[model samples]
Target chain A: MADTNETVLDMEVIGALRALEADGAPGLFAEIVELFLTDTPPRMKGLEAASDAGDMPGVEAAAHSLKSSCGNLGATVLVDLFKQIEMLGREHAPEEIPSLVSKSNEEFVRVQSALLNTK
Target chain B: MRIQDGNDPNSVGEGMDRHLARYHELKDSGEMPGLSLPEPGNRVPASSAADGKLRDEIIVQLCEGVADERRVQRFREAWTKTVEIVSANRSGICERFPYDEFWSHSLACGLAAHALSKQLGRGNAEEAFLCGFFYRVGALALSCAFPFEYAELMELRSLSELDELKSVERDLFGMDHVETSHAILVDLRMPDLLCATIGELAGQADGGRSELAYLVLNAEKIAGVCLLDESRGDEEWSAIMEMRRELGLERAEFAELGDAVVRKWWEYGDILKIHTRAVTTFLELDDTGITERSLLGLSKINAMSEYGSPLTVLIVDDDPTARVILKQQLVKVGYRVLTANDGADALSCALQHSPDVVIADWMMPEMDGLDLCRALRRYEAGRLLFFVLLTGRGEDEGIIEAFEAGVDDFFVKPTHQDVLIARMTAAKRVLNLRRQIEEDHRQLKQQLCRMAELAREAKDAAVTDSLTLLPNRRYATRRLSEEWSYSERTGLPVSIVMIDVDRFKMVNDTHGHDVGDVVLQRVAEVLREATRSGEVVCRFGGEEFIVICRATTREDVLLCAERLRSAVERFVTEGLAVSEKITVSAGVATRDETTGNVDALVRAADQAVYKAKELGRNQVCA
Candidate 1:
């Protein structure tokens, strides 16, 4: 796995974290990352399976869930990956699923590792 | 330490150093107390440690403590002044400001600030007020500091030239005004985060902040863009993206803010009264912020009431009385009117104001209305201008020539005021309709493109026959009837042909249905080859085909149908297996004045086809 420092968080993310801390919920940071790590993988897998099976609704649901999860964690890069996946799913481009799934997995792993290291 | 005189300076100097050290420690630790310190009247007596100079510095610092507050106040004043000036002298400042960006930005910032305040649970009107006010401070300051640069920047004539401005500013000032202002804000002891946000707003290099920075930066950018009089470049857009990335802002978030901002600006008059009043007070101190505010306010007011509508009308007439009459009438009708003495002045005025419409007199000293019309048609900006030429001679040939020169509507000279207003109102209605039609057309085209894309992907063969991928029996019959009705209504001839393969079931039994399908496809191909443009060929159920031709005569239809029959027979006999020779029987029909309905015509053709099949296959009967 790549080092956490290699994945630099945007200043906005840091500021939001600081704001969250100011709101007296500093622990929300760790909680959000944990939720993302726990929830995102299953959703990603489901998205891939749904795409492979040409299950458009399922693909859309999974992609949407992953997108919101990434946003909550302030995982911007992951959010973008999920957006592409969501677009593809909405377009019903099942053929594009495998590559998008792999790319998203890589981003998720990067974000996950960074979050763990931060904790 | 024990034996100092009461006025000794050494002890006082040491105490001053100690106090200074502690202040720096608090500042660095990000724990500075709120800026609302004790008022000067409530302060304890200063010890000998603090002298007059130190006290003066402290007073300056204290005043600077409310520098953000002061700056915000200044910005509001400038904004109001700008709105007023632009509104009053619509010809002068409207030519300069164009009322595009300022309108958009004011709206966006107002809304985003409202949302952000709510999100932060700040729950006060101050944050909402500040959100709209401070959001565009960077742009306002830049415009004030470098008016000429801003005017040039607004022109945005070329990307390379814009970059040159950036480089020039850096070389001349060591930093851009955006950075300079941000640095000044920092020096004045604003919150570090807000200072960072202001820096980002000024289009400085981005650093990690949160949505607040993104919010401010985006608001400023949108406001800057809203204020822009011309097109921006890739560098500007890239800067925006980089800013977004640094602030973790999505395009949708910005769009949402933009929508909210527009809504707020739309209601700015009601919502921003207190801020506007404060800004008015600040404007009396300095002239910078008032002009912008005035122009913005004018635009808002004009946009709200039809009586003050900002749509420009360029009046071109050499006669002073005529020009005055036209301007007064247009202004009375709520149009922002510009008067030009002749065609030359009119063209320049048209280029500057980009008026929604132009009313021009025919004969002039420098250039005639016809010549101006021709010239305007050639310019890209002139294409959308609603040109209404006022001709002394409204003769048919002259009118045709004016139409050729791209005059959308025309008005006769010495026209009555009521008549002129009616014509202009008609033109406005037509223009509005044209806009609606164009919008609808664009939406329809997009939908069609999407539908076509989906159709290509689905590969459904029901509407298209399975064998030849031509229109099936149902689609063919429907299309034929449509063509027939169209031709009948237009009093044009319509033609139809029905073809049937001879002994098709025998071929299917001899060589499996797959081979028969291939033969059917081959015959269908031959039929397709024989048909002309604007003709339909389709599989009409098993072993049958139909063709519909438009504007065709009976002789031509017969010849075409005969050719199709011959081609299919020759192709099948020469190209197919030796065990079977294929042929087709065809019947052709043409509609004349006597034909009452499309179905009767088809029935007549079907009878002829049956006769040909019965007499013997492999021939055409009409």
Candidate 2:
């Protein structure tokens, strides 16, 4: 489970999140996970729709939003993929973002399951 | 120290460094003036202006180093633009921008820069003036654009040193005034070379800036020192000395420069109608920091407001997640937290709730944290809000900007709970200090009112008889003299009725002093009640009373005396051991040709009382 967690969500990011919790706090890590879970799907849909329509600015905005949320959750692979898409969108590289968006979606599913299991 | 602490916040720390630094610089060159600086009063007076032409000549003098007419014209245009911006925005920016202080410091900078340019012979005086005048234009722009934030920044800057202020501004506003000034100068169509040099020089520490930038920076420092209190910190003194030595300014030349800047500052103050406090000379900068420090060093005694009610914190951020995170952490640490989504909402919330501390995000959609802070600072109640800015930007300049925007504390994004708690602890200390100050003011006001009330009471007590609740002998004599003078002036008859209790000593001996006291009190009540308007009644002495009647005839005065005698004779004394009815002897005297003065009038009345006693005790005598 530990190895799986490391593969899905970066352990260092998890450690940092855990550190945010106080002595008797309900837990910042859990709250952040919930925020990531609820927030990411719409952003993922937005990125896919924008990429399909070849709207680079739209893709960039959606990707930018997802990157920060994924970064907080230690979903390193998704963060990396979304970062690529965001850069591509910024640079107006229309052809490359669609593949990256699918990759982000795939990695996000793994991250979601892994985060839930930890909880 | 008192002067420093009580002075303008911008002037609190570095205000006296130039003077003190000049002292050290001179000492280093073995050319120290006497330990005391020249008196500030020795400077040239502000000359009366011939209005438009003299102003133009002063402008010419400022730009003396500029030889080209076209370039001079361009500089004049720029000067006009500066004036336009100030005049146009004066009303809108009245609450946020400190217009007097901004101009005072700017004009001083222009003067100082021009002086330095002339003294060092390195840069054109016109360029120096432009650089000095426009250097902090970004500060004005920022204050106008984001008033609350800029106000907060200034507030923070006042309490902090230059270094700390730089970081705080960066944290709060994403850029410090140097960058803001650079941007503004570029936008204003200032020459690129000049703008670039100023931008380069404004941020560098101690070394590695161009000579022009160096001159302008030192000029700015001089301007700050001139306008602010004379509080010397060793750090500031060393920095100023380093700059002085680098520029090779002799102590005498520096003193002259100070005098020149102050003289021009006063002259500009008059022409511009910007109020100016007298700028102190390097030697004349008063060092009252110790007294100020003592005043500020109040013990950290927690007030009832602190212990009784939980410290309320307003957390303002556009991101709900960020707000939740901060709120949960603060609430866990025993704070009563309120949340606002953006700066505008946060401000209204702050104004309504008056939170002890405000934790706001630097970046919001419409009005950011600094804007909210500035807005909050504009209102009297919001000035004390311990604003803590949360920012994603981690730059030092950004931090300084945040402080300048009036943020008490700055935290980078993804703040840890422990960090938040620690920041809150610091916030509480600041809040306590504010509360302590307010409590001190309230107590001082109460004490003043009490003292005033006591003074009024003391004034009254000097003339009032405590035993009879009437004017005493002293008051009677003074009143009689006043009446006598009035009668003398108006040729009106003024009469006096002197009444004594009949056999008062016998009454005291028979019934004891307590019963005699009751008799005297009852007789006083009758006398007080019987007198009409224009009749001044008083307890003259033991068992004796006097009444001064204005515009009354001798016959009427005799009738009034008899009325008092008969009233006392008829009244029964109640609640006393003795069953004796209280009575009084009566005498009347009116001011006539025979009456010499007020004293003689009283003597004639006393003689009539003796005559009344000889004839019969209860009858009236005249």
Name the top lDDT candidate. Answer: 2
lDDT digits (tens) for residues B501-601 of candidate 2: 88889877754555567677778887888888988889999989999999999999988898888887776354333446677788889999988888888
| Model 1 lDDT, residue B166, Cα | 55
lDDT of 2 at B241: 52
Assess each prediction's global lDDT (C-alpha) against the native.
Answer: 0.57, 0.68
In terms of TM-score, how similar is model 1 to the real structure? 0.25
Could you tell me which 10 consecutive residues in candidate 1 chain A have the lowest summed lDDT?
A17-26
lDDT of 1 by residue, B1-622 (tens): 0111332325445422322332233345542211212322343333334233443442232233244665545433333333332233222221233233343444445445544444344423233333444444333333433456555565763222232455444443233434444543454444444555555555534576455554443445544433333233345445645654554546555434443343334334222221111011001111111122222322123322222234567888765534544554455333556778888777655754567788887656568888788877755457666788865322345788889999998776445545766777777766667667767987998898678758865864237775687888878877877887798689888899988888889877755565577678778888788777967888988988989888888998898898888888777655443257788999988887787777878888888889998998788998
Q: Is the docking of candidate 2 incorrect, acceptable, medium or high quality?
A: incorrect
By summed lDDT, the worst window of 10 consecutive residues in model 2 chain B runs over: B295-304
